[model samples]
Target: MHAVLLLMMMVFAAVMTGCSSGPDYKIDIIKELYYQKDKPSPFEIKVTEAGKAVTGLTVTADLSMATMNHGTVKVKFAEGKDGTYAADVKVPMNGKFEAAFLLKKDGEKTEKVIEINVVKPEGVAKINGQWITDKDVSFYKFINQLQLEINRDAARKNYSGKQLEEELAYLDSQEKVLDDQNKLLTQIIRLRSMALLAEEKGHKVEAAEVDAAVEKARGQYAQFASAQALIQHYGEEKFWDVEKQQYKLIVLAQKVQKDLVDQAKKENPKAGDQEIYYQAQKQYEDLLISQINSLKIEIL
Candidate 1:
């Protein structure tokens, strides 16, 4: 019985030593934390051990704003493509909040805490007061594609060093043009935002109208053998879902522009067709600038 008791005490000491050693991994927040109130704000946390990503871990987050008396909210993080754990959390309001990450792996548990600031966004550049990064990424991707195309053409022509340098300079000029075009596209998005506002105020484009527009667009893709072929060319699900929404937005923008022009005509009955159109265009441009100025647009 004494021998058994001594063995038990030895086991207990070993267990205590193991627990006291703490976790072998380090947890770090990947980037600056800025969240828009009530929006799904995505963040990444990296776990590393000896300069390598620590895999196969279960990570969870608990968030609370102490000063604001906000209660704790729990969030589960999923493993991301780059070996980091990611989560989209919605904070209740605009303020400073504390986020505590609890990580568990192979019966070992560890934790890290971070503070984040949430802010309310302003103006039409935001959708539901949240800044979107998808459009920004898409814009840069397009620019990169343009650069690649230019390089391919230069290579095909067998351009040497000096010629290659000139070609690259020309590509830089083209990039600036594309950048200007992107600015115009952003303005159009702001115009679409105005359309969305109109939608909130009971102005809606009918489903039938959107369906007709989509059908018309499909008709323009006659080079494809069938709708399925067209879908395959531009990703089946994306062509249907994302392209359909894009068509809807286009139709809605058209309707909004027409409404604005009609209002302009009514307000200035003596104005010619060209004058009314120009006035409506100017008004829309001014509105976009106003919206951009008023919005809190943070890229991160």
Candidate 2:
């Protein structure tokens, strides 16, 4: 009986020691989970102990909600770089979620529970993780349609009756083309891509330049009553604010164009100004294509 008692005590002590082992890990949500409509949300978490990454562990998760009858979502995480594990988890809806994670390494297992929030991105597309929001696309459409109306109003002076009807009809069709979302997105992408390259090339647009460009645009629009009415409808302050941002980027893009024009002139001193400008324009287009291809663009 004494020998058996001593062996039991030893086993209990061993169990206590195993339970008291160090380096307990904790899992943290990387970001508020962004849920997709057509597929599983890309869920990510980081595992750390003593503020250091805990790696080489197998992590599996069960996602559930306390208020819902929906079955739990079983997730098998795949490790990414720097102690991050990701799983494409499909949840019933966007809201609070409890993630029960089981992390195993070297026969040692740790369980942790983290509360997560899932939401949807506000944008229809993304470039390098920067969202081009739906409202932004809507504003572009509005601007395009407004410009068409301005042209139609100007054509009223030169044409009348049937001729005026044809001109207005053509302008209306142009508005329809402008309403294409992809076409507007393409325009935005082209402008942003060129502006990005201009910044990389160390081009800077001063506030004075943006102001001058805005004034130039304002003066051009001032000639048409329809332009004034549209600007008033859009709210002059808001319209000018948006125009200032666009013109700032345009100023940057102009600098990029000027750089190409200068390079063309230097490369072909004998070429006339017209030929040089044509070559520069082609080079600018090629450069824009290359830059766009390098960007991380995603259209949802």
**lDDT of each prediction vs. the true structure?**
0.67, 0.84
Q: After superposition, how far is residue 87 of candidate 1 from its true place, in Å?
A: 24
Best by lDDT: 2
| lDDT (Cα, tens digit) per residue for candidate 2, span 1-300 | 999999999999999878753458878876346667667656678889989998898999888875676679899999987898987777777777788888899888777777777678777777777788887797788778778878887889889999899998888778667769999999888888899999999899999999999999999899888888988998999989888988988999999999999999999999999999999999999999999999977665
Per-residue lDDT tens digits for candidate 1, residues 1-300, read 999999999999999887663476677776334456556666677888878888888989888995888788798989975558887777777788888878888888876777776555432133444554455435334534434554546454677688777876776665555545446346445755666655655677788988999888667554334434535655666555655766677776777678779989999999999999999999877765665565544333
All candidates' TM-scores? 0.43, 0.64
lDDT of 1 at 190: 73
lDDT of prediction 2: 0.84
Instruction: Name the top TM-score candidate.
Output: 2
Q: What are the C-alpha RMSDs, in order, of all predicted structures?
A: 16.5, 6.8
- At residue 84, candidate 1 shows an lDDT of 84
